[model samples]
Target chain A: MNLRIIKSGVLDTVQDQGRYGWQHIGINASGAMDRFSAELANALVGNDSAQPVLEMHFPAASLFFEQPSLIAICGANFSAVLNGEPVPCYQPILVNKYSILQFERLNQGARAYLAIEGGMNIGKWLNSYSTHLKAGAGGHAGRPLSTDDEIRLNSSVDWQSYLERNEFRVLPWRASDFWEKEPVDEIYILPGREFSGLTELSQLSLTGKTFTLTPQSDRMGYRLLGDPLEMQNREEMISTAVTFGTIQLLPNGQLTILMADHQTTGGYPRIAHVISAHHSRLAQLSPAEKLRFRITDYSMAEVLYRRQQQHLHQIRYACQLKLEWFIHAGH
Target chain B: MSLTIPYHIFPLGDSAMTVDFGSRISPELNSAVMKLYHELQLTPLPGMVEAVPAYSSLSVHYDLLYCSRHRPAEQTVFEWMGELLDKRLRKLDYEEIIPSREVVVPVCYDISLAPDLEMLARERNLSVEEVIHLHQAAPYRVYLLGFLPGFTYLGETDERIAMPRKMQPSPVVAGSVGIAGRQTGIYSLSSPGGWNIIGRTPLKLFDKDREPLTLLKPGDIIKFVSISKDEFEDH
Candidate 1:
């Protein structure tokens, strides 16, 4: 099965979990920025959690289906139209051959995931299909999809049978079911290496004051506008390793949260790292959305992380049972 | 040789740790970094996903789940990392090391790209030619790649070329070469920068088309070669 890109989105690319093991070679782990959504999209379509899926940013992509297949849309609910019909998201849908799927505009949030039953067929480097655009590696020629690009699928199953057997609407699964949502205006953060170096007032302001996301935001980072944070001392710390969710303070006292596709190392004094538990909230935050930081300790972050993992494990078991019953019915 | 190693280990974040070989930049630390880097690559601990070696430290990324599963009796993964670092440095220094490959980068000192070359020369109390000569005189090593993707942070420029960054950063053109403090580098992509602009190269430092796209890597040595505008454009 092949998908022909009629119109490319702002920045759409095929991505899986990510490429690890090669950070020693100076490669950052570039993958789906909101990996949880990517996994859920795959799971909804009876694909493995690790399967590669299309990551679309800001919609506007149009594609033509070459064959009948099972698919699902997860993440930001962009306005998607299938053959001029509005298609529901977060569930499996069966589309016949010659169907045209057009993602017009992003009505909410930034990124959305499109997962086929099996997965996207792409050449792998270092054991992943995720593209590291900076290093020019992985995915389709190691870059974002362009107009007229054709993407092939690995699945050869008879997915058309789903049309007669199951409802086309999404099953009862929402990100909120497995992970809790953060306050609309508050972003949860864990104090980081330079947390103690901030002036007492700056420290207090970090948790109390609200900041608005600037337009200068992308997969690389989120720049914020707010009261400038002051450092206790003016010492310039040596540059070191930086990661996604790392909140770095600039010379002008502005804050920038490094996101997916961020550099592997940085020199700025990091004030905090958004806890993984709240990363989805950060992911869905739109430009100009006001957000406040709430400081949490390490212990709480760890406990929250483990609890989320357990919920994910339970979801996986439930999906396995659903698939087993479907197959046994035909037998 | 007596095997006594002194290093500092610190928290990079909750999930990872960094072992710094020294407090300041020096050749010893660079060697220590490479030595420890190779050793870790040869024998990575359980759950360790990556070991990123920089000018003075190595950052290790590991899977917390696997690390806990294989947790040793003596310490947590963080403590075990510290102990392993000590053992790694205790061995005899791996002398007769692999020589860093030299990459000659062609740069154009033309009027358009180096718009501030005259101003920079006046601040440094030197002629433009002298500035270019000093920049090309020494072979610099790649210290790390950061601040942006494919942006190479190089080490050890001739001290005569040591200068503070531009007080007000001009919009840096892509491929512009500049010096800040004692380090020198070329801008791989156009972004806001304060480095002293001396010249520009035509080579695409961060093109997505090339395999292993970046020409420079840590432990690699580079020398800037002055070229005519035509020569620069041809490459």
Candidate 2:
């Protein structure tokens, strides 16, 4: 299957779980900002969890499907439309040859994920299909898709037969369980190594007040505007490795939460880390969104992470079973 | 001589932990970090994915699922990892030899290539020739690779020419050799930088097609060799 980019909206790029095992050498793990949605989209189309999905920002891409293929859309509802008809997210859709899919406007969330059956056949650098924009490597010539760009999909033999047998434009069943409700905007974080470095007043301010995401926010980090969180002492710290959810305090008393495209290492003092379970929800937050932080311990964080992973595993298994049954019934 | 360094392990998040050797930058501390990094790589514990060595610390990232499965049921992932790291720390032989590479970086110090050469020399009350001589005279060590891919942070420059970063960062071309404070490095990728650009190199610090991607790894010894602009262009 082939997809022709009709209108490449702002910051549309192919991303997977992220490039790992390379951070030691200063490589950012550039991946889907909202992993939960990306994985769900892939699962809806019976694709592997690590398969590359189009991570589109608000006012997402418009594409032309060159062949009949099974696809899924998830994450932010960008008012997706197929051939001028509104299409719902969190389910598999069958697009006929020459059908145009377009996203009109953002209904909710900051990003969206679009997945096709058998995944995108894009170039993978450092064992990942993620595009590291700064280095200009990986995923479709290491850059965002532009108008007229053609993205080829890994064609599956069974898909051709399924398309011929099916008359409906979408699967009867939707992966409704995988769809998360609207976010509450409350982010839970665990105290970091330098949590104690913050002044007592600053520590209280972290949880007692609200913070707004500043305009300077990007994939690298979200520079928050709120109370100036001051540290107890003016101490110098050596640069060290930082991860996706690391919250760092700048010298000017500003707080920045490192996101999906965060640098491998940073010198800013790490104040806290947003738990892994809430990462997808955090990714969906846009600039100027009001958010509050809640303190949680390590054990609680681990429990939440494990529970989410278990939920995803169950969802994947169920989706695979459903797809298998559907294919066998068609035969 | 055998040397033993003390270190502390702290949790960065649910999925990562950090082993800090010290707060200050020094050859000994960096070597210690590299040694620990190598040791961990050679005998990786359960769930350990990667170990990132910085100037004086090593950040170890792990897979929580794998760790939970392998760890004792009674202990949490953090507790299990802390204990496992402590055991490894006790067993590590500081006397064990660590491996490193010596790399020669060719630089073109022509006035045209170095946009900030005249300004830097004037600010330091020295001739441009003197500045170039001091930069290439000493062998520098790769403290870390950060800020950008393949951008190696080399340290311990001769204090005579040591200066601060530019008051404001401007657009720097790739392979621009820059110096700020006690460190000098070549920009692997073109981006805005505040460092004083004293020369340029033809070598690509980072290439995706290359085997290792980066030209210099941490702990490698780097020696700058001055070459004429013609030599640089020819290569």
Candidate 3:
């Protein structure tokens, strides 16, 4: 079975939990910027979280399904429509052969995850299916999907009789616990290694003021514009290791949050770091969105992270039981 | 444990932690950073993912969900990992050094291929031949790999050949051998770069199909060998 791309959207590429254990050689872990949503998409389709999924941006790719399959859409709500009919996200849907899936308009978020059961038949580089754009390796010939590109499907289910009366079927069960969370406009963070190097005013302003994500942002980093921060004294820092969610204060006094594809090391002053649990919220935020930073303790961060983990676990378990029953019913 | 270097460990975020040596670039400091990185990789903590070594610091990334759930209830994952790292550092023996791989990178310094070679030599009040000689005189240590893949940061070039980065970034071809301040590097993939390019290497520095992906790794000792234009294209 092959899924044909009718129209490719901006920055649409194959992504998973990202390529890891290669940063020491300047290789970045270019995976799904929002892991939770990607994982949720997979779980909803009864696939493992590490399976590769189609990560699309606004005006996402219009696809032609070659066979009947169970799939789910998560992350940014681009108002996915199947064969001219609007399909809801965060739940498994039985898509019939020759069905056209399209993302009509940008209703929310910057990127979306499309996960199919048994995953896409894509090649992996460095043991990962995530596309490393810079290196031009991994996933669909290591490039963004263009029109007429065909992606093979690993497994196909016979949902013809089950969906005989309709073009598609939206399953009753949804990953509610996984999909619902506290609305996250305010991003939670912890002080970075160089947080204290900033002037007292700058330190206070980081949390006190709101910053706008500039258009210069991408998979590498999110450039933020706010008060020009400065340090007590000008000191040249030796380059050091940085990670995803590290908020570095540039020499120009502006700030940039390193994302999934951030360099292994940086020389800028790291002022704060966005908590792990809020990375999904941060990744979904489109360019030009305003966000406020809140300084929280490590204890609070740990609690929130554990809560998010529990949510993922619950959703995975809930979907497994429902998927078993649904797949059997289709037979 | 001959702990001569002073270092501090801190959390980059809840998911990652870093151990930094003092703020300076030297063989001694980088050796210590690599040692810690090697130790961490060999005996990783519970849920440890990867350890990245830089000029004078090492960042340790981990599985947050695993660490958070498996760590002692009283201690946060950060604290638990920090304590583990502290124990490792306290017992870290810096006496034995990890064997570094020696690599010879060939650079074609013909006037046509070396766009900025003349300019760099004129500014430093030296001839182009002098600049090339100075650059190739010593074996530089590969301190770190960042900014780009296969773009190894080999350091401590002769001061006479050192130059600041270009005011504006320009398109640099892959295998461009360039210098910025006292450090020199080879451009792994073609992109915009600000370094002072003196020559180009014919070797494929960053091929995804290549074993290890990158030609050089941290703690590597690399030197540049001058070659003619014919030699550059022959390979």
Q: In lDDT terms, which candidate is top? A: 3
Q: Show how many residue pairs clash in every candidate, following the order shown.
A: 0, 0, 0
TM-score of chain B alone in model 3:
0.95
**Which candidate leads the pack in TM-score?**
3
lDDT of 3 at A208: 95
DockQ scores of the candidates: 0.36, 0.73, 0.84
Cα error, residue A140 of model 3, in Å, equals 1.4
Candidate 3 chain B lDDT trough over 10 residues, lowest sum: B1-10
Query: lDDT tens string, model 2, A62-88?
Result: 899888788898888899889888888
lDDT of 1 by residue, B1-235 (tens): 5544477776554456678776566766777787777778888866777888777877877765565446675565556655665666667375647577889888888867787778877877988888888888888888776665567778777777688777887788778888888888778877789888878988877755567767777788888888998888788
- The 10-residue segment with the lowest total lDDT in model 3 chain A: A176-185
TM-score of each predicted structure versus truth: 0.87, 0.95, 0.97
Chain B TM-score for all candidates, comma-separated: 0.89, 0.92, 0.95
lDDT of 2 by residue, B1-235 (tens): 5467888999988888988888777988898888788888889878998888888988888888788667788898988998898898877777766677899999999999999999889988999999999998989989999878888788889898888888788999999999888888889999899889999999999988898798889889999999999999998
> Who is ahead in DockQ, 1 or 3?
3
Docking category of candidate 2: medium
After superposition on all C-alphas, the RMSD of every candidate to the true structure, in Å, is 3.5, 2.1, 1.6
Segments in model 2 whose C-alpha atoms lie over 4 Å from true places:
A157-168, A177-183
